[model samples]
Target: MSEIKKSVFDAMPQDLSDEFFELIAGNDEVKIERIISRGHTSPETGWYDQAQHEWVIVLQGEGEITFADGRIIKLGVGEHINIPAHCKHKVSWTKPDEETVWLAVFYS
Candidate 1:
């Protein structure tokens, strides 16, 4: 077989602009998704009752994650956190003038 030589930043699909979501692997036992999202948030919007556990990290920019219970967490470049399944959370606030790049991995 031939070698596949390409950088992750270079090989990201051209058609998928605004954000990059690559499904790296999946199976009955586990699933993995590599994502690079920039400025992807609903301003003034919130989320609730997530169905799956997710581990999220900030690749760049600045933002805050909030939960229904009034828990707040701040994320910046190179920071990360884990959210349990069914945890009601949302992007409470983000830098309006900057892009927030996030990497999220989800699993059951």
Candidate 2:
């Protein structure tokens, strides 16, 4: 058997003026996505209320997340968290000098 080789750090756009998202895989019940951020944050007046549960990991660099109720979560490399469906959250900050890479799994 042959192994399929891929790299999570590949294809990063040189111009990181905005965050980048790549959909790696998806099925009826689950979706895998990769997000690259360099000093990115959610809109000032908005929060993400997702319909599906999301499990996210910081693969590189660091980031901070804020919940609607004022709770804050800090994540560095290899750190992860599970967000329940309909939980309101927003990304507060990401490392500015380097890319903060994240792997997010969404499931119903």
- The sequence of per-residue lDDT tens digits that candidate 2 reaches over residues 1-108 is 556788899888898898999998889899999999999999999899999999999999999999999999999999999999999999999999999999999999
CA shift of 48, model 2, Å: 0.5
lDDT of 1 by residue, 53-94 (tens): 888887667878888789999999889999999998887666
Model 1 segments more than 4 A misplaced: 1-40, 43-46
The deviation in Å at residue 13 for candidate 2 is 1.3
* Top of the candidates by TM-score: 2
Give all TM-scores, in the order shown.
0.66, 0.95
CA-lDDT, candidates in order: 0.69, 0.95
User: Where does candidate 2 have its weakest 10-residue lDDT segment?
Assistant: 1-10
How good is model 1 by TM-score?
0.66
List the pairs of residues colliding in candidate 1: none
* Model 2 residue 43 distance off true place after TM-score fit, in angstroms: 0.7
